[model samples]
Target chain A: MNEALTLLSFGEHGWGDTIAIGALVTVSLALASLPFGLALGFLLALAKKSAEPSLKLAANIYTTIFRGLPELLTLFLVYFGVQIGFQKALKLIGIETYFEVNSFVAGMFALSFVFSSYASEAFLSAFRGIPQGQFEGGQALGLSRKQTMTFIILPQLVRLALPALGNLWLILLKETALVSTIGLADLMREAGIAARVTKEAFLFFGVACLIYLILAIISSTGLARLERWSKRGDTAR
Target chain B: MTVVSSDTALPPPPPLPRRWTKARILGHVLMALWIVSGASLLFYLVTNINSPFVQKYWPDYVDGFLVTLQIVSVSLLIGALLSLPIAAARASRWKVLSAPAYAYVYFFRGTPLLAQTFLVYYGAGGFRTELEAIGLWTFFREAWYCVIFTFSLNTSAYQAEILRGAILNVPKGQWEGAAALGLSQPVTFFKVILPQALMVALRPYGNEIILMIKGSAIASIVTVFDLMGETRRAYSRTYDFQAYIWAAVIYLMMVETLRRVWDRLEMRLTRHLKR
Candidate 1:
């Protein structure tokens, strides 16, 4: 027990600093991708809700492909595939320097795609929850299509989507661990290194699990509060 | 008189035309990003299908597919079996039984499966001495076995909750009806209640299986050569984006097939419930 404490202690000889940095990286990765994911997903919902068969088909195909594929598989594809694509394009342009995709950038890109695909479904459901009369109401009030979307539908859509989006955010947080496979110094990777160096595999991994559990707990509480706040103006239950 | 005259004059405007103008114009306006990316991706896929990619990596992918199928199926079977008792425990009135069951579910549901897998795979080394003493080291030592063990435990938590929910969804009248008819509790549960409960569980079970199929890709990180594993290997050798793309295609096909099959099964099972 004493030895375990020493190993995890925040000192030059301990791994506490490394693990703390990793936890920060994991949170930042999830944070950076959230806006991109939410925006893309809203667009997807719009596309699905549209009248054009071709546009709807495109949106359907995008969600099907991303949602079906494994998160790790998507990560590797984006990480390696982007680098390869860049290298080829650079070759074509005669800028012979080898190109690379940063692990953080690649991780964010892949997570955003996966998050958006899932979020699209949630957003679509939120759209369905709105009545047809609401759109007609917007029109009767002389609002343009865009104005109807922005001023009328958008606020309620955000409220309806909050729960599903919160769930997706948790999934995204867990998925950030996959970036560790590609050498992003996330919580999982740091734990892995600490385990290897100290030969205390159980201790570090257990610590990592605890950290994740705590984050999940906090997010659940935060989401509950946010949901309550969103419902403040809503009609009596 | 005008309303009736117009209603008679206009052969009910086709449902399509009314929605086409407004929504289509919005769709076109919102699809600027789609126009560029969608066209490029379609072009890339069309141009690359015949590029000697499948020919080279098809065998490896096939092997990986079989492995993937084996692990997922085996773990799911084991998980379903294990969930029965846990579900019972969770549904029990006793705190002794229910508390631990709830903890199991909470831990597995809250934490990432990747962390759980690593905990079992590498963390097994921490217990090397104790395991060897108990003649269980061999089981924990192999990545394949560790993965199966972790996945089974992880999925069992999810399955248990589903089972508990399904069983609870059966009305109180089910129990009372069985008692009034002089049927045994176990008999009533097995014969009268479970069938109805299964109907409730069917869709969630399908979703769970789909999740397992996707989650199984992490087995590759532990040196298990599942489909994603083979894709990584192929990509390492060729550095071709096509390798990962092919893997994605195969996975999507699997998911789509299962989705169709499950829908059919759900329809068949619930035919009596519908008109």
Candidate 2:
């Protein structure tokens, strides 16, 4: 009991600070990927809406491939895969340097890429949910297609896309833990390390879960507020 | 814009009008990231072909992939079997039986899979002495057993919801008709309700099976030599990160195959509904 308490303590020797930083890094990674993922998702939604066979097929294959694979598998692919590219480029430049791909970058790239595939499906449905008549109205106003898409089509799509996007983000946040497999000292990894050293897996894991739950609660609240804000624009219609 | 407007007036775009426009070319260029990422992974493994890393660990990755496939297939089979009874209980009229089943589904679904996996695995470890006293430690001690136990329980909750939703989607008239024929409650469920519900449920179950294939990789943490486990081992021994890339390639191929099967199944199931 004493040993467990000391291990969990916030002293210089204790891992409390390290674990806290890990939690911070996890949050930062999720936030950084959010906008990029949204953009990727929007493109995917557009591609899915394509009338052409090959374009539609391409979008279908993209979502199907990413959605079917495991998050950790994707992470491993991105982690080492990027390293291979860097090494090849270095060789081409006649530099023998071994370029290290850091864990933070790897985690960010992998999570965002995977999150976009799911988000694309969400956004595509949201786009489909809008009545065809609204677009007709946009055209009736003499607005160009691009203007109609930007001003009329997208804002409403965002509103419709919010709930599913929120759920995807929640799943994405929890999945950041997989980054630890590549030696990233994220919240789960830190907790695992502490658990290993002390052999008190329960205590550290409990703390890790508590942190994740708190993160989930906070993000859900923020999303609720955003949803409310998006709804305000619906009143203009 | 003119083409789009004309096409809109005609109801649906023309069959094939040079699908790859410049905008689409740009879109494809951007999405080249995924293909590039996948290609980079392949390059990593191939370049490291003659490295000691590949020589020592290539067999391990193959063995690990087999184990992962085995674990995922078994868990999906068992989990789907178990979920039927639980779904029935939840959908049943008895509050005593239904409430507990509902709570179990809710709790498991609400939490992340990783936490639940650890809770079951480590929690079992914590209670080993007590379990031994009760003569259950033998079963709990094996890594494979623990992995199966955790995965089966985890998937059962998700599958219960899928089944319950499908079952409820069955028309109430089926029950009335069954009763008009003097069928028993069990007979109505098994014969009438289940068959219809299964058509709805099977597609989602396929989705769940694909998900389980992914989730089984988590078992690597518990010393189970799944594909991910082998990758981790190779990286640790050789410090050649490409080993992990090979594992990921294998996983991607397996998942892509499952996705094709799922798409076909969904297409067949919904064919009658389509125009």
Q: What is candidate 1's lDDT per residue for B127-181, written digit by digit as tens? A: 9999999999999999999999999999999999999999999999999999999
Candidate RMSDs in Å, in order, are 3.5, 5.8
Which prediction has the highest lDDT against the true structure? Answer: 1
Question: Best-fitting candidate, measured by DockQ?
Answer: 1
* Candidates, DockQ: 0.58, 0.32
lDDT by residue (tens digit), candidate 1, A1-237: 888888888979889989988899999999999999999999999989876876787788789889888898889888988898888899998888877789999999999999999999999999999999999999999999899999999888889999999999999999999899998999999999999988888899999999999999999999999999888887565
Flag regions of model 1 displaced more than 4 Å: A234-237, B1-56
CA lDDT, candidate 2, residue A71 = 84
Model 2 error, position A188 (Å): 1.0
Per-candidate TM-score against the hidden true structure: 0.91, 0.83
Off by over 4 Å in 2: A1-20, A52-54, A217-237, B1-21, B27-59, B89-103, B235-242, B266-275
